[model samples]
Target: MTSSSPLHILVIEDNPDLAANVCDFLEAKGHAVDVAGDGLTGLHLAVTQNYDAIVLDIVLPGMDGLTLCRKFREEAMRTTPVLMLTARDALDDRVAGLECGADDYVLKPFALRELEARLKALVRRASSAVTPSVLRVGDLEYDPALIRVRRGTRTITLPPIPLKLLETLMRAAPRVVRREELERAVWGDAPPDSDALRAHLHVVRAAIDGAGEPPLIHTLRGVGYRMMAPDAL
Candidate 1:
């Protein structure tokens, strides 16, 4: 297999030896790895840095991994995929972890091979689905690759989550994108709540439509949302 792009991985495990071992193994596989002994520090790193994936332990100090994951989603609005690690093998724990925003889970005592495979699958899926380059909705444009946005001659700068939300909408321009779809696109499979989508939409509207050229992003009542040129109507 062709080596994929180096993925930045954050490991939040309290066990010093295990954490170091996992990090070392991932780094040896060409991934850039960072280790945090506590959930709070891991959350901070995850929010501030653009990590390809996170390996989080359920039992942690300062903050538990589940709470950290939820907090990260709520506060930073980050959509980075997470693989939750847990010593508990109960089905309820697994379900709860998934509900909390974990894309995948690996029970403790997992083989290194299993961990590597899960990480690879997560990263590959993330990399293949969307090109984080640019998004276009008629004359309006946002180039994530360049970290810039433009409507005609004017350029705009947006904070990360709002930009991500706008990009998701722009990618589905002219089509009514369902609320659930938007949540999965911008926040991953495990989303906060239904209201979160509305809040982000408001921010997107203010930034993209408030200027008054012509609103491109539109809500389709109960259906979802769409972005299209005003002339297209």
Candidate 2:
């Protein structure tokens, strides 16, 4: 995407020719683009640094784009818009990518200008959505509007996805939200294939139930998770 001030972007694609073409076009448009030949390097760069947007490829060594994108949301807590690249025109791959947290995608052999347009739309959507001011369950609090969480006096910093998950749980405090329902809220129509939810929940719980705090996020065995003060449970 072209901006008045240049935007920094990451492109994680293994194809040398394709990567070079994408980078060259974006650089010509005044955006700084960082290339990662594989998923591992891409994940590292994305986790450690901040980028305005990411252009990710679905297939790569070390890790796939689907997992990398999911980790970006679940672990890094990054809300940076992602534009996924794929060679397949199959609907399943696109859905899988979106479910894994990609903001958008373009099939391979596409126009550079079209990719750029989708990337611009992704950035705009990330910036424009309005979220509620506050959601609380007892001492636990999550502010989607500001993108912050708090329990008692402790402030919990979570990546965007976990934070959203926390908000969903807290808003339904003391009630066991069904697995299907929570998944829909977290990943929209497409959820992860593996048991990825629990991993993200672990990070959320670590931050939310640290030290003497009674765990408010409770797994309801076969059901789902519920948020409530221990006394309330």
Candidate 3:
């Protein structure tokens, strides 16, 4: 991502004037902004859609900001950077907001420029978390930011699960990745039973292997799987 790249932002504020001002200012900065007037609407959008950053208000009708933020983090498993809007004197609310998972908070009477700067900082942090510097093994390469795979010069697109599987494999390149380890990396604590890991690995292997170059993924008989150049074996 570049400094000029437009970010998709979700602004959940009840005040019309504040919402308009924020949306307009962020829009002027070349960001695509989505506005929700209530916490319910905001929570729905935040959970269902993908946004680069979120500007959330502390109080809203239907649900409070803290509850919404908590649900967004816990239920959705999302780490989208959140910039909270709060009154300066609401010290308790600010503390509670951070506890509920707001990345940073901006005072109600904050300077618009300062708010934008903090948001950009949060975006930089979040981007770094999701997009590794680079992952390479042999002649294969993957850019997590772009979510694209390449061998030599040919680029390929993959579905979300296979893409994640490929990332796990490439990150552990030339080493055997245990089945349980890959499952936990891809599916977390709630992995599917009954050889689901094997099924997904099959798809991932077919996508990254077979056609381009030699097969890089290999089964290790009774143990697990490893990725390596053909000659490495």
Candidate 4:
């Protein structure tokens, strides 16, 4: 799989063998996987961490998948796509999963290939709808086509480099955009210098996070940068 094709996934399954097989298959596909053996732990990770998609089991310890999915959607206010796994083939069971916000469902003993394909579809759907004509995160708004950037009622102006960086960050808002990814988006393989991203990001921070406005651009030090409203933090 290409670097861009790899998705970070969360696997919430109590069955050790099934979990291992699923994890191995997904990892072999160049995806990152995180495993949670119980519902409570799964819910914790689901809320606190970020994942491209989730594979959840219906029957779980501590909390059932239905309750977990409901809490994730209602309480946590997350829109991450969830593909539920269950041994039950009943129509009501499947409906329950969907009613609780699961995007897709798979009966247990499913093919690993099928599982991955479903996840890919879910991620594709989410990514497709992620960006709108006017991208807004908190009070920050960016219109890529119009080349307009604003923080609340205040209009902001930035240099070309910083504007490009801002667009990249806003497009991946609330998700950490790695330093390498930022460099590629703006300057491709030929970034002027090692410190070029840092310098440009500094400018972006200053342009959008002026006084009276809540800071939106955050540096992750060794990791990367993420632009999110304070509530998301």
Candidate 5:
């Protein structure tokens, strides 16, 4: 079955020929594709960017698919579906792939049409699953889909930068988000000068924790930031 809308996909394969074929096929089917030749680069892109699904090769340079998938789930806390590609058809390999967080598996030398269908199915299932529509830290609530932020009964207006900062912080509430992680999430690979994050953070802090409100956002000097109810501190 063909996808109803375009999907943004990442292909993490070390083989030049296979990577090119998969990318070309997916693009021809109206999907946006990003390629990473090795596992390190793949993990970086997977964590920093939003993707509908990922096509990962089991064996990769720098790091293997299983390790990257585990880190993506455990360290990054992302729920993106992963469909692993491997030449091995052994039951142990399949089980290992699943145990490491792959949602589906495809043996290499497989049909291109089948690969596309599997990727589409994974995206469909993930999209249909229920997830928290809004993210919150104490009184601060962010509706990402609606592009709205509210603190208690007050509707907070924020510029794009501050809004992104707020959402990132809220998503990782009660857990300190590293400054570099914040920068990458907002600006991707081309982060501006170091002071840019500090300036935008000030904006977020002021807008989110106004007068008389127990400050929800906290900064750890030389470290990073986190958002949580004051009582939890």
Candidate 6:
């Protein structure tokens, strides 16, 4: 799988030893690697460069991994595939990481094989073809291709992950999209807990509904979500 166009990887870890070790391993596997010792630097590199994948550590000096991921999406408008590395194995931590836009997670003290496998999977998914370009519900329209969302004549700019989530919801508009289904669509098979789905939904809601329209993404409390015009309900 090592080709002339080697995969570019960014390792964002505060621990110099761990970062160097991971970089050495990935480099040995015929990949190009860059290391960032702090969250802020890592975020800057991630946004500025076009990396095939990112290995992100949860704990850092300036900013945490979760906050860094959110900031990258919200501020920098980055959409790189992220693999979160953390010692905290709690479900909540996992959910928080994924909700903030990480694509995969590996617990600390993990084997190199597991980390490599997760990295390959994340990159593979990221390289796959995305959903269609545009989605519509009632009079509102969202273009995943252009990354511009429109309600009536007004256009809104949404971050990448939220736009993807909104596209998934709008594709199944007027129908109840199960929580697990949405998770699979956005985060793949190894998604975090259900709370992560809710968190992303909250972000999406703020983007769509904050503009003075009825809520199109509705929760069924326990079942799932439905995209319907406010007037319809």
Best-matching candidate per lDDT: 4
For model 2, state the Cα shift of residue 97 in Å: 0.6
**Tens-place lDDT digits, model 6, residues 1-233:** 33244688999998888888888888988889999999889988999999988899999988999999999877887787788898886666876776687766677887776677667766665565665557788778976655578888877654445666788889888899998889888667766544556655666776678777777778898798889987777
Q: Any idea what lDDT model 5 has?
A: 0.80
**Comparing 4 and 6 on TM-score, the stronger one:** 6
lDDT value, residue 1 of candidate 4: 27
Q: List the residue pairs that clash in candidate 4.
A: none
Enumerate residue pairs that collide in model 5: none
Off by over 4 Å in 2: 1-3, 129-233
C-alpha-based local distance difference test score of model 6: 0.77
Write down the TM-score for model 5.
0.55
In candidate 5, stretches whose alpha carbon ends up further than 4 angstroms from where it belongs are 129-233
Scanning candidate 6 in windows of ten residues, the lowest lDDT window is: 191-200
lDDT of 3 by residue, 1-233 (tens): 55567889999999999999989999999889999999999999998999988999998988989999989887887878888888744445555666577766666787787777767766764554465568887778899876568888778645444566788888888789998888777555645434445545655665677585788888998798888977777
- Number of the predicted model whose TM-score against the real structure is largest: 6
Per-residue CA lDDT of candidate 2, range 168-212, in tens?
888887788988887787665756534446655666676788667
Give residue 221's error in model 5 in angstroms.
61
What is candidate 5's lDDT per residue for 1-233, written digit by digit as tens?
A: 23588889999999999999999998998999999999999999999999999999989999999999889987997878798898986666765666566766777788898888777766765554223479977777888776678889988755445666787888888999999999887666656445556656766776778657899988888898988887888
Q: What are the candidates' C-alpha RMSDs?
A: 8.9, 7.9, 14.1, 16.0, 15.5, 4.2
Which stretches of model 1 miss by more than 4 angstroms?
Answer: 1-3, 130-233
Arrange candidates by lDDT, descending: 4, 5, 2, 6, 3, 1
Better of 1 and 6 by TM-score: 6
* lDDT of each residue in 1-233, candidate 4, tens digit only: 23359999999999999999999999998899999999999999999999989999999999999999999987997888898998886666765676577766677788898888778766764554223478889988888666578887888755445666788898899999999999887555644336446655665776688666788888888898898999988
lDDT of 5 at 49: 100
What C-alpha lDDT, on a 0 to 100 scale, does residue 81 get in candidate 4? 82
lDDT of 2 at 199: 52
lDDT of 3 at 81: 81
